[model samples]
Target: MTRLGVTFVATLCFACDARMQLATRTSDLDEQLTIPSDHDLELEIDDALGKKHREDLDRALDAREPGEQLEHAQLSQLALDRQVFTLDDLFRVGDDLFAYQFRPEQGLGNGLAGHVGIEAGPGAAPNLRRVQQNAFGGPDAMSCGDCHAVGGDDGAGTLTQNTYFRGDGDRTLESDVRNAPAVLGLGPIQALATEMSSELASGRAAAIVMATTAGTSVTVPLTAKGLSFGSITALPDGTVDASHVTGVSPDLVVRPFGWKGHQPTLREMIKESFRVHLGIVSLVDQQAVRDGRVSSSLYGDGPWYDVDNDGANIEVEDGMLSTMVAYLSQLEIPIVQPPDDPSLLDRFARGRAVFDQVQCGTCHVRSLTLVDPIVVTHAEQTENTASPTVAIDVARAGMRPKIQAIDLIGSAYGVPLFSDLRRHEMGTELASPVEQIAGGAPIPKTQWLTRPLWGLADTAPYLHDGRAPTISDAVRAHGGEAQASRDAFVALPDDDRSALLVYLLSLARTHKLVAP
Candidate 1:
């Protein structure tokens, strides 16, 4: 209701590349800005939220003061819709957002422990109430940069930044400890997934039609973008036997984000991250209140929907998600930078050959051909009003050194992503203690998403969690579907193995060198 700053709504993006530099620099407001890692909410409680007309919600707000404020108003989504801001401008704004450190005054947190979003109702992760205050404890991080600062901007998180999700907030062992993944080249990844899902759906539909027409069972190999995803058998009765289908969701959709690959779109993934990591609810979250999905913590007669009763309405505005996606989609792609030295370069080549020799490329495929480069964002009517989309050509229009731009508009090129973006059984060694509950159902404990290894060299402490300190350890820790590759890597000669590591280490992300 009481919107601030920019004309309409847009924010929460374009960092990780610019975040570390900004985050490392001290700010004048640094001393006063902090989320105390303690459940000492005794001082947070406050008075009336203006009226008795909405007595129950207001009383709840008063009791749980929430104590949040907004320092800067968000940018309007109209800026992108009306072409008032260019792609570069959107990226720059998103960068500012990604680096902006939130304080209590700017509506940061309302309990990530003991509850998910400062509440104990249907929204709470029931067992997680008395968890650690912050520091991988709950939604206690002050900013995305706080955790995503280890390797580079939008890089992997270190041990300190690991987060415990969907568990008893009090204890570390009871929760899911996840290492924050690098947030680079997400647009193409999501696009590839979208295309894959469509192809799979079409394949399934064709099988169904054939089966119905022929009045017999029709089995078809599930191929998308030239790779096989096993097969599906369709019977004449319009029933599909998907048990033979491999490596994808029951819906046949590929989720390129998350350790378990549950998220479908950048908008959904980014919004979820803000809520789970920063306690900042977006307009989409407000929609949850209307849908009776997530509880509404409305405070007083404000025009904006207050999700956590933090009094900071529209914390992450409606349009911010779209631009953020645009910014993320355009960030620089990772490069296969081999060492310059002759011996080391030789090792890199050997490792590349060995990578295939040992079959690591079986799942960690060297590259995938993307037929189309256009990644469209914000095409849905999420939080009501202004459902506009910006289509970015992933092969062009990004923060320079666009390494993967060879496949120009409407062309196909190999994306050296080193991932199939499919789920695999990681065995007990790499598996988590508990199954990750996503979209209501529980994902199997051993099934893990194939992490894109484009930025592999920079993202430290590998694996689903940050258990493996080095890449070698991560390789040995592999099991289930990757067990064969892991064993082969282990049995390799010392020199061969070293060469393999060199090849893996070559998978580095590129950053601009700025001379100040």
Candidate 2:
């Protein structure tokens, strides 16, 4: 269980005009976001104020065009196809693709806007991008940048950007709501998960062997990366009772993505996202269709090239997914930013102490070490197809603002993501309306992975459903396993409570100038 990400976004709100445009409160450099050429786009960024800063963001997205219309994104796709990494080239291509807007002509939806041939209006083309909620998916966004543009190009989203997943495909009530999460330092996150999974597997295997040899039941503590996920009971009968297992799923694999800890690999997350979030199907989708896991082609059962019913074929290329993975995996990690004022700084320090005092650090582990910094990614491949592999040392290939340490608590490097990478029963107060389908474990509606609090302040409107508007509100909403910490927080003095809030606000993304 892990969700590690950050970006250059601050939650402080400033005054804006009556139009309700988004104000770039990050920095002066954020005012002029540089949209890379070659991957130019022409968009109709909306002016309607869906949430806090969306109007201005939509306007900004619309301004990202380079005059010429690159129909069907052919030029950008060509550019991505040629970028086979040298790490440098992957970053260059990924940087552009992360913010590239998609139009319906490029197959951006299955049915969010409507069926494949339905008209939005008098002359509007079919499958016009809409933010409507549904069971199958919202396909509610035009680009990754649309929802992720809270504080940066790769930041978390506002409540307006929340989407309902795993639903009835028609009604919004039957779906699971999810907030758009920030994406940062994903390469190393996968690396850490892989290492931890191996360690847990070895421990479980040892427990099984011991149980068989001794002809008695044995319980093994599934510990990994210094975090404890309780113990699993194994019997000589070859049955494993995971009744006491905490955090991780039944199999002891540490999936590091999704609020529910669903995805095991970053590439798989990207591949699913392309099809579910955006209508652009990947090679994985094609394989899923062949295996009868999902239906492709909205109309005539699309050929292998086009999975979505949209006219475009091979909308998202395999190489494009690979480059995007490289780009997202290398995004900047979050940093602690204390206030400059003496009083506030004192409050922040005290709040930091209070954070530990209230046992918030138990689940939100202050530091977790990444023993192996090298991350391997595989291109889209089926059981029969060959997938190219790209191995990158995130410590070297990652963007700036790396979380550095000397001894690193007896590991290769420190990743201060402030999470134990385990799931907890969040209780009925925060339970999803739907049980939902996820990979690995049978996650109940009341369970959720401990979201990494590295960029807590930047990603406002907290919680899986984006129900909490502030950090304090988010803390108050905690139930189940976190109830003790929440009770401790409630018992604090008024000033200490304020101090605690101040300290949590310091968990923000550091200042950096980035072009998309």
Best by TM-score: 2
Q: Against the true structure, what is each candidate's TM-score? A: 0.78, 0.79
Instruction: Estimate the Cα RMSD of every predicted model relative to the unseen true structure.
Output: 15.3, 10.4
User: In model 2, what is the error at residue 386, expressed in angstroms?
Assistant: 4.5
Model 1 alpha-carbon drift over 4 Å, by segment: 1-73, 111-137, 293-304, 379-386, 403-410, 437-441
lDDT of 1 at 31: 11
**Candidate 2, TM-score vs. the true structure?**
0.79
lDDT of 1 at 309: 49
lDDT of 1 by residue, 1-516 (tens): 112311121132234323332222212212111222233222122111211223344345545654311222135665556767777667755665676667543556542224334553223321222233332234557777777876667777988777877665566675777888888877778778988999999999999999999999999999887788899999999889988777787678887889999898888888877776776767665766757664353211123365454556557765677767877888877767655443354566578778999999888887777777788876343643565667887778765435353434645756778888888888887777776555455668899888888878889888777988999988888999898888999999999999989888878876533222
Q: Give per-residue CA lDDT, model 2, range 1-516, as digits (tens).
A: 011111122222223331122223212211111222332221111111222143345445556853122222222333443544477667655655566667767566642234556543212222433333342344666677777877666889888777767665555574787888888767767887899889888888899899999999999888997788889998998778988888888888888899988888888788667666776667656766767776543322445555445556656665677777777777778876665443364576578789999999988987778777877766554542355466777777756666565473635787878888788888799998766455534688898988999888888889998999888889999999999999999989999999989878877775543322
Q: Looking at candidate 2, what is the lDDT of residue 439? A: 52
